[model samples]
Target: MKIPQKPNDLNEIFKNNIIKLMKLFEEKEVKEFIGEANNKYIHWDKLRRLKMPGNEKPDMIWALIKLSRMVTYRNIKFNKYVFNYSSLSEFQKRLHLLDKGMGGKILSNNGSVIISSQERERYILSSLMEEAIASSQLEGAVTTRKLAKEILRSNKKPKTYSEQMIMNGYITMQEIIKIKEKKLTKGLILKLHKSITKDTLKDKKYEDTFRDNNEVVVGDSIELDKIYHQPPNYKEIPKLIDELCEFVNNDEKEFIHPIIKGIILHFLIGYIHPFEDGNGRTARTLFYWYALTRGYWLFEFMAISRIILRSKVKYGMAYLYTETDDNDITYFIDYNLKCIEKAMRDMNSYIDRKQKEQTELLNIVKKIKNINLRQAELLKEAVKESEKPITISEVINTFGVAYDTARNDLLQLSKSGYLEKTKIQKKYLFRINKDKIITELK
Candidate 1:
């Protein structure tokens, strides 16, 4: 991506057009335009293209927007820099919706659970797989989503470096869930990085350790000459990380909403670039850890990375905008909040689709007597792909059921003529008995 043009200095614009700017601010249309611009948090690059009202220049409008934001910006000290962000109306509206949606209040009108206990596990597993694949893809992992899901579900050893990256991401996400209760520490961060970069980095020593040399610069992968960011000096990593741990662990000084805090943690890791590889994956995992630990239970079902992967350029620009524009992290925070909102919407759509599928599966069960819900689901899947053989292990992994339970479900379907079972070596493969199912339904 090309580097964004740095915003013109706000002070210079104010100094040059003091009387004109003051008079424009009093105009109703100018005030309305400022409100609209601030709500979207329009950066100068895009702001400059907008048609100015009453023949005023776009930079004057940008100056006014910056002036308004400065009043509400809150400061955070990180190492030698002081970063700030403002909670605009847009942010507040989204946060309110997210709090209502993700704070364990996901229920139907009847006050019963929207996602039942049985469905919760399946959704969580699907979400983890999605996040793993997309996060790896964001880092340039080359694999189809279908192939990646099959690799994860079959628990097979990855055959390529790209697959290895995806597998590492999956394992790291699971590990984050397991250790969500622990406080953020440099050690914990290293552990997560090790899991995320296992067998994927060129050097083994860099897997769990910070880089000792300032050789790493985030540059455009295509152009190779355009540098996007240069992280802090390598020698300062330990102290910077120490300060980061304290910032995340202790919340007494000020009140940052849990979601915002999580996004900030995500941005800091990317900014710090403490490791030689897998910094992006580690940063995203830490965001999930912070959110899950802070009681956003619904995040386990939301794949924010999947949404981010759809707009990879914007994701990169959010960081660039924050860094170039005087460390005003509102750009990063705003981008993440929008991604989270989309993820939440996607999660709800997924639940609705799954619920519809379950209803259809129930209808199938009514037609096929003596079959359980699990068997009915298998039949539904088999109907969709009759030629593909289903294995006991696949069933177990998909449903999170015991080995015996998966075996019994497949065997019962075979005996009932809903599936055709064949033994190859010591393993049994089940396929849809298309003729028998057609005859029975008739």
Candidate 2:
């Protein structure tokens, strides 16, 4: 309960532009701005949420990551890039420069490439990501263990949070369908408990936050950087947890756009900061879980964490921005809206790429002179899997084949041009041309 009272203080965040934008955003027209910023003389070029489902909708993470792309696209549309770069990387670099020069980074309080420990800020980002994804795609959840798996998947060996390694991108997410059928026990919980830091349980930092201890305060006497630096007041923690659990579990707003509801839950739970450690990660994962509960994307991919990793500065700025203005949530809303807008555009682009890739694979399949029933079955399975590129080992197991025999079939098909090899790590990945196979079947 010890909140910072000044800008210079670590707990205190003051950002005037955010306040100014909130005032401007109060106008009702701002909420309707899908394409209006280009012609207006507004202080901030606010892009409104389209409230439309993407052509090929993504899950929670997909939605967050896509927002980055959407925001980038909108910036180029409304603001000049001053270059005709042929690739997205080149384009992004130019835009990043322009954004920095125009005070985007400053306005966002993100001069540093990596954003550090500000549990409150992470809470806000989690809420924003949930809202953004719900608005464009279906609902879903990101489990803590799932996230730990992600961190593990990245092939890093920090053994602890450090630098950019603190990113939530590494959280492993499995489909809700995959989790609901299971039961949680002491063993399961403890096994998964290893995913986060153990000191978090008793570390005053985690304790203050999880318990919601009100004794902590950011008065003039306390050092500035240490304000958001304390723990949560745990005395009344159960009350807030019950309140959010009730709302999330049985609220009448079930019919409301799951995205909006997800955002609301994110704020409440995060505001509660229920865990000793990994509260931020927990809030975000909860948001993901809430989205998934309402029926969302499968977890073969993750995008929201990626979005957090990407616009971390803006993510932090939103938190600090609100602090300077008597805790007015309007700036917070605007910041999230922008994030949502960006997610939509990113999803659009992803859908476009996925469709394009599938199209090319289909063409490759059709040109094949001969494909028997067996290859046709494998092709069907690949399409049905519909996740990241499937590996050669998967093929061998799919039919319970001998290693060399499976290898021969894959090599022959790859050589004959029926399948494409996307990458070669421990094993190769084979992508079949489903579209071509369908055409041949027709």
Candidate 3:
């Protein structure tokens, strides 16, 4: 008899991951990790409160979740590079493995390998993740080319034709820029989207290629790759994506931390495998965007994927441990939290050092007599931007007052002999004198 496909019956990955994570909330390690590190590295609190440039703070949460959906997808795509591939040459030869399980495509499991289907599901997820960049940024007019441009802007490289051919679900980075530069019409998005779909249709022609003559998947049917059970229907995936997108956007219920929610979103999305091609990437990116949208930047600053990528076994094991024993998503959440906590710890230390220095500067400012608020701040900026002193024009620009207002702020401290003025033509620049903060007031 054939083995059953899929590992479990749970429909939501987030629900499972979150359920597992709740136990650690009261632990000493968890407490030390969040409170002591406050507003430093894992600044989920800060991000939650942040004001997005063009939108309200709360509304930005959804946008961030959307953004994370894509970024998570990208991180996972690059991650597989470390495994599966023995060498770059081997990958270049066999990358066609990308299309097998895309769009609900599945193959029968055989011995050792899902040989016909190896890596196809993964590749499809990567393409879906790539689509997210455009989905979040451009909205209705998104095309494959537009999506490619979005990736190029973020990753800082142009896409080649081969790259576009491989990312059959979305536009190549090269084509995205082509549209932006006015070389391609807005209508081109329709053509490109259709073209990618058409290209993917050809994968059916090669189904046998991924399959052996035996009509079953080959290679290691290790615990990781075998259909934990039958992969779900294609239509069912979008529902999970929509539900998760909503969960991350929730504004009510403050006691449950937003950081927890972000991690939960990642777990649920990964488990759902909503997109045939880009589940892992989508999970990570949405995890990020979820945090970002929640104004959780201090925590988001850590780039969770970089942490997860640092050790694939731990990352995978975290999933396996939580996936089996129960429907608990706790392990996944805790692992992500720890990864974020570590990043925040690094950031917090840096912040604490800077803040300590800021305090010292403030004390020095206190010693200067007749030092107005502007000059005190100027001193602070001078120290922070120690590479150079603040220019009079910069002070004026920062304050949005008169040029003379800038000069006078500088002049008061200068007369106190607490500041030194440098001149170029008609303009003056100011620098703090040594011990000036101490000398000016007395």
Candidate 4:
């Protein structure tokens, strides 16, 4: 994409009469400059489309953006990167609601306000799997969700580059969960990169190593020279990374909201591009790491990647908006907040649908005296349209039960004629018998 044109110099516009800027700002049109969703935090690229001139031109919009910024870190002044809006607008407040919704109100297995430990574990596994699949897809890994999930659930070895990428994502996310309480360090960051890109990068030597050469550039394959971003120089990477860690570890300083700080960390990794490969994956993973570390526990189960994948062009544009417009970063923050909002909405909807399915299953299985909730849950999944044939390994992974327990659960269902069991290649697979299940319900 062509680089966005920079806004005209605001200094030149206000050089003669500084009060002219104030008078112009006081005008009714200026006061009423509320843009639509498309115009929210109007970047110069979009603002230039407006029919205004001189001081009232799109440069005025840039001026407004600058005016809106509230610097979070006073120490980083020259390239004042960390910032947010001076005041939260209604739009931002609504998005904050979504961020807060991570603390979901759903009842746990124990009928408590807090999630039961068992249910929380299940949500974490589901989240890890989702993030793995979606993060890999974002980085151009091609594989079906069904197959990727099966590979993870069965603990089968990954056979292809795409599958490896998915597995790497799963492993990296799990590692992040374990280390969430630890402070960020260069070593930990490198370890994460290694875990995410192992067996996937073309140059095996560069798996965990920060790029030591200036050859990295972000842009389209067709036009390599038309660089979208040239990250900080390789020579400066070590110091930059150290500074990033310090910033992330600073909790006692003038407080930056944890959610916003997490978004900033996500943007910084992309801006720095410390790795030769897996930068996007690492950046996204680090976003999760920061949120979880900062006590945004429910963020573990929200798949931001799925929301971002739906509008990748906008995702890229959010970065461009920040880079082109004085490194305000509010643009990127706004975009991420929107993604989190949508993700939380999606999570809530998923819970509602799953609860409905479970309720229906309970209603049907109430007549059967001996079955457990786990059995009923599996049966509910079996009746879904185009459901895949089940396996004991899948049951083990799904319910986090032991191998013996999962095997017995399926065996009991099969014996009751709710499932048809068959063996292929020494592995037992169970297919749902829809007619038998319906008859049992009747």
Candidate 5:
């Protein structure tokens, strides 16, 4: 990504045309100027094209853009990096409203059914698989989603480097869930990095350690010379981290919205590039950590990285837009909020499809046999996909039934030819008996 051109100084631009600027302001062009800035809180380069016919001077446009920014602070101990953003605009207000509405839906009774309350473990596992795979893919890990899911589900050790990265991410996500309530600390951050980069980093020593000697750069992959960002010197890292933890711990002066605070935590880590490797993965993991900790239960089911991976270039541009234009974080915040909204939409679509299939399966099973509701639901899941294999423990977990009750449910299905049973080690695994199922259901 090429660096955004720095806007010309506002004072220098107006010095030669003070009278003309005054005239424009007095003529009620002040409203127009503010309106232009309000359109999208866009940077000067992008905002310049929207300039009115008579308002084409680059410097004047630049000055007006500068005047629009509202400074916000993210306190780091020794060297704080203050950011600025335009006050929330109409677009943001609508997005937040939509976001809040969606969040509410996911926490309601209907939401529980949509999420398969009886099979929450499965839903959570599926979400973890999707997030882990997509997050690794964002860092250039190469593996098909099908193959990755297979590897994770089968409990097989990862073979290739890419697969390992995906597995490491999966493990890290589970760990994040476990530790979400714990305070964010330097030690915890190190633990996350080590978990994610274990056996994956080329330089093993870099694991679990901040980059003290190595130089890190964010730039175009194809054109490495086009540097987009350079993080603070390593000497600043310890104090920076202290400040970061302070913010995370809520030992700060102001109250930032939980979602915004999480976004900033994500962006600041990437900007700092404190670690030599796994910075991206670590940054993303922190996002999940902070969000889940703040009681956004619906986030557990969101595959945000999948949405982000689809538009990785825009993801980079969001960061660059903030850094290059000024410390304005609105660009990055807006992008992430959109990503969350997209993820919610996808999640709803997934639930709708599953619900439809569940109904279809239940209807078919009811016609086939005098089965209980649990058995009917289980059959729907079994026949829906070859990937969904049932174990006694899962049935017990999903339906909150006793072990024997869950076992008998599957056992009865097996005896009735609705499912095939296989003994793997000591436990039984049941899957749809394809031949019997298709013939009977038809």
Candidate 6:
């Protein structure tokens, strides 16, 4: 993407006409515009396209909006730059909703747990695969979602670099969950980076180490000549990272919400660009790590990257807006909040759809004498993909159960004529018995 237009300086616009601008802000139309603009956190590029209220110029209106934002801005000093964010009404609404949805039990409108304990593990596994694939894809790992899921589910060694990236992401995500309770430190960051970039980088030496040179710049992969961001100097990385660790580990005097703090951590890794490669992947992983550690347990089942992949342009523009508009990170914060909200919504929709399917499958399978919920779920998958064979190992991974338990579930279904079991080589493969299942349903 091309560089965004830098916003005009607020001081320059309001210097001679501070009194006139303050009076103009009281106008009804201008008040309405400011309210609407603040709700969406509109940046100058988009704001300039909108027609001004009455006779007001866009730049003048922008100055008014900036002035309104100044009162609510909370500042953080990182190195020499002063980065700030405003928690607008919309932001608070989102944070409240996200806290309600993710911090406690996720419930539907009717007040029922969206995911039960029995099925929570399955949902988390599926979401982790999705997050891993999308995160890798964002960093230019080119592999089909189907192939990536297959590689993860079957525990097959990745034969290609793209596949390796996906596997590394999956591994790193699991590792983050295990170490969520640990304090943030430079060594821990290096360890996570090593796990995320293993076998995916060109040089092994750069795997867990900070870059020593300043050649790295984030640019548009499509438009190779257009540079989107030039990170801080390589010499500043150690100091920057030390500050970041302190920021993450210690609670601020003036309360910064955990979600917002997590998003800031996400942005800092990208801004610092401490590593030669895999910085984007590392940044995203840190976001997940921070959220989960803060007791937002429901985040384990929501893939924010999947939602982000759909609006990749907005994701890039959020970073550009923050950089171009005087180090105001509200733009990036707003973008991520929306992504998190959408991911939660998407996850709920997915769970609802799956619940409906399971209800239907259970209704049909309840006619059978001794089939269990696990058997019903397995049968549902088999019915959906009748041509694809199922393996015990896949079931073990999907259900987070042991090999014996998975094997027994399939074997019982096979013995009851719901599935046809055959030995392929030394491993057992189960196929849906289409005719028998149709007769039973009928």
Every model's TM-score: 0.95, 0.44, 0.35, 0.89, 0.85, 0.94
lDDT of 3 by residue, 1-442 (tens): 1221223322343345444334444445544443333212222223445453334333233223322222322121111111010112222222222212122322222212221243333223333434433332222223354445334322323354333333442333223323332221213322333343333333444311211122222113455464432333444544444554444454563333556665666676556544333345445545554554444423322334445555555666565544442334544655666676554444445445544654565676567545655577677767555556566665543444467877788888778766687888986767777665544445
Give the best candidate by lDDT: 6
lDDT of 2 by residue, 66-141 (tens): 2223344311010111111011343334335323333221111222322123222322333333332321121122
Q: Write the per-residue lDDT of candidate 6 for residues 1-442, one digit (tens) a residue.
A: 7677887877888897788898998899899989999888998988999989986788899999988898889999889868989987888899998877755666654566656788778888899999999999998889889889978987788998999999999989988999999989999999999999999888999999999998999987778888988989999999999999999989856678899999999999999999999998999999999999898888898899988899988899999999988889999999999999999889888877776776786797687668877788888789899999899998987787789999999999899889999997999999999998888877
The better candidate by TM-score, 1 or 4, is 1
Off by over 4 Å in 6: none
RMSD of each: 1.9, 18.2, 22.7, 3.4, 3.8, 1.9
Question: What overall lDDT goes with each candidate model?
Answer: 0.88, 0.41, 0.43, 0.77, 0.78, 0.89
lDDT of 1 at 147: 90
- Give candidate 4's TM-score: 0.89
**Predictions ranked by TM-score, top down?**
1, 6, 4, 5, 2, 3
lDDT per residue for candidate 5 within 296-393, as digits (tens), equals 76778889999999999889989988887657777888888889888988887887776776667678767887787678878776766866778887
What's the number of clashes in each of the models? 0, 40, 62, 0, 1, 0
lDDT of 4 by residue, 230-343 (tens): 887888888888888998998886677788778888988999899899999999999999998977877877889988988887888788877776676777887888888888
Model 4 off-target regions past 4 Å? 16-19, 34-39, 53-56, 60-87, 90-116, 385-388
Model 2 stretches astray by more than 4 angstroms: 1-172, 175-224, 229-231, 253-257, 296-302, 323-326, 369-442
- Residues 28-75 of candidate 1 have per-residue lDDT tens digits of 999999898888888788888889888788888888888888999999
Question: Candidate 6 at residue 372, lDDT?
Answer: 79
